[model samples]
Every structure is written in structure tokens, then in C-alpha cells.
Target: MDDFREHLMKAISLRKRIRDTRTSTGIGWDIIEQDYVLTWVLFGISRLEKLQETLIFKGGTALKKCYFGNYRFSQDLDFSVRGDYPCGDDLLELMIKACDIATQSAEDVAFTCKRYPEKSPHPEEQEAFDIRARLPWHKDFNTSVKVEVTTHEIILLEPEKRVILHEYGEHLNASIFVYKVEEIIAEKIRAILQFAKKLHERGWGRSRVRDYYDLWRILQEYGQQIDTASLPLLVKKKCESKNVMLHSVEDLFQDRLMEYLNEWDHWLTPIVPDVPERDVVIKELKQQLYKIFESDNEGVRVNRTNVGAA
Candidate 1:
């Protein structure tokens, strides 16, 4: 346990360095977290493929990479199976079978599975599932990683559309089973607008507005990449109609400049004190990394500078 603690501390230090560099360059933490999540999600997908279970990538990761240039941060891993896929008894059994296999192969993994409640009984039923896991220790045995997995029934508004949404308003010209980019973007845009309205109703302050602003910037960046000529008129119609009009990019740039004017004062605010529990978890993970460094394996390094960086 002592060894583990030491390794974990080293890893945390490295992570901190990387985080600091990213922040200095104005990169969001979400992007780093998403990359870590993707590694685990890909592992789970490989397991499903080995079993020959019918699954296809869906949601933000797919949309972000194939369409947008990997700019967005996705918190959940999403997959979809055919509506008619055969299964015995309840949906819960199928979910358990998948989670059980994923957990068995995953290190420091945890999972929860649940069914999406039916909106109406007549036409069809849909189910959803989620899995969470810690990332494998690095080759050098420094740092800790974590991710969440989710699965849901496929539902596309425009059943026949083939385009998938990407970051910056671009779309990926690919098919993932029954899902398409157009539908995904439409749904996401609608959700963003809804959330923005909710924030206003609750009288949320600048931070909440900034969150939506970030999302909008990502969408606009991708959206500009889209080729409207090839899409079905309906898809283009929706894309053209939807707008998040929070503020223009120029306005945001100016706001950021103003924020820097009071950056030190903001950091000193009492509301922003560091939490010890979060630090402890980070420390343990870094110790695990340090152990990897000490071992005379193919890949290990004990660099204090690296530890502090992470």
C-alpha cells in the first residue's frame, strides 16, 4: 500500500504539469478528460466485438472525431443496438451480461445498468445502460484515469438521413447502424437551447452563460465545415434554423480579456478554496504511477518534474 501511494503521487505530479500547460494555452479540461474516457470506451467496444454483440458508436465522441476534429469533451460513452435484436427475458438480463463481461476484463471498474422507462407501451420499448471504469495505469505506472460508458436504444428523428453531426457544425458522412449525424446534431442543439433557457429562469450567473458559450463556439467551429449541398433539404433546414445567439465570438474574446484583468482577485475568492478529499484521491493515483516508474520494466521513469506537471 505504501508503494502504491508513492507511485500515485508521482503520477499526479505529471498530470498536474500537463494540466498546467493546457490551461496556460487556454485549453479546456473537458478535452483531456474526454481523451482518457475514450481509451476505456474503446476497450469496452473491443470486448463487445469479441462477443459478436451488435453495437455501434453513437453520440458526441463519434460526432466530435469523424465530423468535428476531436474538439468536444464527451462525458459518457454511448452505443446502440438494433431494435429487433433478439434477447431472452427482460432487458435487464441483457444489460447485466454485457456489463459483466466488460467489468471482468477491466481493472478497477464499476458499473450500473438501468432501463429507460417507456414513454408509451404500444409501438416499442427502449432500454439504457451505463458502465464506469478507472483507466489502466500507464506503462510507467504513474497517474490514474476514469471513464463512464452508456448504451441506449437507437432512435433517429429523420429515419432515412445518413449525415452525423461533428464539432464546428460539420457532419460526418458515415453510417453507424440506424443513427445519423443530422438527427444527433438536431437533438443536441435543441437540448442546448433548452438548457440555456433553464439557466436564465434560474438566474444563473456568468459561469453558466460561459458554459453554453463554450458549447456554441464548438458547434459553430464544426458547423462551418459542413457541406450543405449534399445533405437532404430537411437536414440543412434544421441546421440553418437552429441558433444559440449567446454572443458573437468577438464579444467573448473581449469578455475573456476583461476576466484576465481580475484573474488574481478571482483566484483569491473564499468560494474557491481547494478541497482535500479530491487531493487525496489524486495523490493515491499518482503513487500507483510512481511504482510503475520504479520497476525496471520496458517503460518506467521516476521524474519529480513529471509528477508535479500532471
Candidate 2:
């Protein structure tokens, strides 16, 4: 109980600190709120890591907070397990426990969490939780944080440990599981492929601009570190697991990467300031994707682009 109180006090203190630091120009209050929520989420994940060794953090938030520094503010926490989570344990209950532990560390905000059961039979598409957090001091700001669990086999090749610092302050450190940089890059590529597949079947959905941006950012910062030889197989395995078939990995890249280009600036400009000029980013990404796909098919060629239309 004392620990919980300490967390609550620290949370409130951090909340005030974040509120006070919201003077940065050109960034909206909503974005600042998003940052605040992200801070709380990181603190929450830190607590979970202490209590649950099974859940290893992955995805955009992990990349942003743990490895990649170039990503825009991400709204959710994603995790994958080494194997099936024990049967009959409610995910929401588990998150609540994690949240409680988090509140103990910083109890400034109120957390409301709801579990959405897995809608698909595929093990990879596991259940998710929607967490809505409201700071008691800031009535106008209620942030939504999604927590998605990936049941697919997470190959944590060259896993790295990162101590996540609450941006409002640094004394609070939360350690998290982060996959190798190359694996994360492969995952981003896989995300674009998956997004394309979903779009083809449904005709409309969320955008994959973030994946493109993250891919570009990683390639720019850690391009040499990415395991070039292993990427295609990794991406292929991911597509197979999701039952998402692709006629050609190169074609998949050409179609999706091109499509995402049209909306890139619209979605990316606000969050990522140094967003490379369109032609530069697209050209660079195409070259990288082609290299990843070349080992499998030599016929891979860059699709002609009408930069003006895009």
C-alpha cells in the first residue's frame, strides 16, 4: 500500500511536470497529452516487467522507447510471449494488476481498461486491451492506450535491455525487452505487407505511414546493422503465419510502399519533422526493400513513380 501511494504521488508530480513543460511551439496540446499518456504507459510496462516475466515488449512503442529514437509518439503497448499464457487468466485482470503496480509508482492518473477478446481463430491475432487514462488534474485530457498481445513466436534474436526513462524526469527507470534492430526492421516491413493484404480484402482501413516512416528512420540510422540476409525469410515467415499470401515480395513492396507515399506527408509531417523529402525517402526505402527481396528473386525491379501524382 505504501508503495502504491508512492507511485501515486510520483505520478501526480510527473503529471504536473509534463503540464508545465507543454510550451513547445508547433506541437498541439493533444500531442502533449499523448506524450503524457505514453509516459504513464512506459511506467506501467516497467511495473509489468517486474511482476510478469512472460510478457516481452515489442512493436512501435518498444521501438520508440527502447531502440529507435526517430519514431513519432506511439499510442499503445504491444507484447509477445515465449509461449501460450496460462489458461484461465484474464488479460484485463492481469493488466489491472500491472496498472495497480504502475499507479504505486506514479498515481497521478486514473486508468480504465477493457479487454477485447480475440475475434479471429489465428493464434497470432490475440486479444487486446483498450486503456483509457484520465489525469485527475487535467479534466480535458483523457488519453486512450491500446495494449495488444502477439501470440506468434517471437524470435528475440539479439535481444537488448533498455531502461525507459520517464521523460518528465530521469530518476524513474523502467527496464523493457527489445528485439534486435534488424528484427524490428523486418517486422516493420512485415507490417506494410500485412497492411496491404488487409487493404486489398477490406478496401479501406488505417494507414501504414508509420511503418514506412519507422523503416526509413531505422534504415537511415542503423542501416548497416540490419541483417540483410535474414530479412526476406523473416518477412516470409511472418506472412505465412498470418496466412497472408503474396505473389511476390517485391511486388508487395512496390504496391504498398507506393500507396503509403501518397499519404506520408499528411500523416508524418506533424510527428516527424525531419521527414525526408518524398522522393528521397521513397527511393531509399525501395532500394532497401529490393535488397531484402533480391536474394529470393532477381526479377525484382523498382516500379516507376509519378512523384507529382503521389
Candidate 3:
């Protein structure tokens, strides 16, 4: 750890010297700081990949950081293991050990990484657990990246492994298991619908604008090519297993989606420099969601036909 600290200090000093020589590009220091913190997190995530072979990276963070290139500056690292690793306490202990390895690996490059065991609010809901990564340099500003692990659902498609090269840092690469784009889109839609349902019933305090933003980005990239046939049914099953109601697509868009749109703040202003206008996003999203629901229903028909033929 001491050796890691020494390397980190030198790197910081070098970064300061470089910044002093260069003219400002008008990018906010807050964003720069966030990028720096992300590099450390990436280093740790890379180490995590090495530690657990079964861990398949998923969710918004994976979409933004590893693939998609949408750059949303997400704060959580979500993973899905191949099997029910939650079967025993020992697997979690092993995962924590892997996190410690990640901390050491990050420390080697001068970033201090610390892990905290986060208690689940409702473990029975999804058998989910959290491990947060605390970065040293960004301690003053949003220093922690929460890593959530779960083994609740099965992924139908085989995950593809890709080597992610850091956009901000030099000489940084991490190979990770990334879910297919279709899989990601399906899950994102499911999340938005589910969250919208919650907002409709519970009346507003917990609006998740990020999910909406992601869904819009996915639509822009994939358009009508995405397969969401099984997504609604999967989400329905998930909600049922958790004893939550599954709302209709029309209800989600008519009421809750507009509510989520209203909550977009500084935190989720699209970290990418060239972002679509808010009104533009809202318009496109409405059109896209309608199309997506139609496509998803069509997929259900296709699947039913294939099963009947079989």
C-alpha cells in the first residue's frame, strides 16, 4: 500500500505539471475530477475481472464505460454472476477478497481504494449485495463508486468479453464480460417501466432519470433492431417474484415517464459534450418507447410460433 501511495503521489504531481503547461479547454474541473476518479474505479474493476471469472459486468455503468460510448458518468458498478453464487456465504467472502485484490491493484498505480460492506435494504427482493469503492483523490467530491452484485435472473445470451481501454488514462486496459447490446436494451427498458410503475403508485420522490436517459441513447443507437420479446415477461416474472405489480406500457409512458423526465438535473446532464436537447430527448423517447412496445409484442408472437412449431 505504501509503495502504491508513493506511485500515486508522483502521478498526481505529474498531472499537475501537465495541467499547468496546457491551456484550459473550457471543460469544468468537476468533470475532470470525475474522469480522474473513474480511472481509479476502472483499475479496480479490471482487478475484479481477474478475481472472479463468473462475474459478468452489466447495467448502466457497463453500457457507458465499456461499450456504447454514451459516457453518462454512472456511479454504480453492477454485476451478474453465472450461477447462484449467493448459495453460500463463502462466495461473498471470496468476492470481498477479490475486492481487496482490486484495492491493491489500484494502489499500485497511486490511487487509494477502500471497500465498504453495504447492507442490503431488501436482500430478499433480489439477493443483491453492495461493495463500494472509495477513491483517494476525489474524497472531497463524490469519492465513492458503489459495486452491486446479484444472481437473481438468468441471461439467455452468452456474454462477450472485450478489452476496455481507458479514454482518460494512458496504458490502462481491462478485459471484461459484457452483455450483448440487445440484452442491455431489454433490461434498461424493463427498469424504466418498473421504475415508472413505482413512481405512479408511490407518487414521485424517487425519480430515476438515468434509466430514461439510457433508454433514449439505446434507441438512438439500435433503433428498431433491438429484441425485447422476452423482456416484458421477464420483468413481469421478476416483479411478481418480488411481490411488486407490473404496470402496462401505456400507463408507464402516459404518466410516469413524463415525471422521470422532469427530474433530470446537473448529475445526469449527459456527460458527453454533444448531447441531445431535453425537449428533443423527450420527443424521441415517446416515439421510440411506442415503437419498442410494439416490437416487443411482435417478438412474443414470433417466440410463441417457434415454440408451437417445435
In TM-score terms, which candidate is top? 2
Location of the lowest summed lDDT over 10 successive residues in candidate 1: 267-276
Off by over 4 Å in 2: 1-25, 49-51, 84-89, 116-125, 153-158, 245-249, 253-257, 297-310
RMSD of 1: 18.2
lDDT by residue (1-310, candidate 2, tens digit) is 9987886777677666666645532445566666666666666655764324566667767776776543566667777765446322565677777666555655466666677555666445576777777765657437777777776655636566777645565456567666666777767766777777767788766788777777767776777866777766666665566665444545445564576668878887666645668667666766666556644333233333432232
Task: Please list the residue runs of candidate 1 whose C-alpha ends up more than 4 Å from where it truly belongs after superposition.
Answer: 1-35, 49-56, 79-83, 86-126, 135-179, 189-219, 223-225, 229-310
Ranking by TM-score: 2, 3, 1
lDDT of 1 by residue, 20-78 (tens): 63564354454453344344334444444322245445555655443454343444555
Clashing residue pairs in candidate 3 are 8-110
Cα TM-score per model? 0.40, 0.77, 0.70
Stretches of candidate 3 exceeding 4 Å from the true structure: 1-10, 13-51, 84-92, 103-120, 123-142, 222-249, 270-275, 295-310
Candidate 3 residue lDDT tens string, 197-252: 66658865456566667777877776656664555565555445444543434444
- Name the best candidate (by lDDT): 2
> After TM-score superposition, what is the CA distance of residue 127 in candidate 1 from its true location, in Å?
3.4
lDDT of each: 0.39, 0.63, 0.56
Residue 215, candidate 2: C-alpha displacement in angstroms: 0.6
Candidate with better lDDT, 2 vs 3: 2
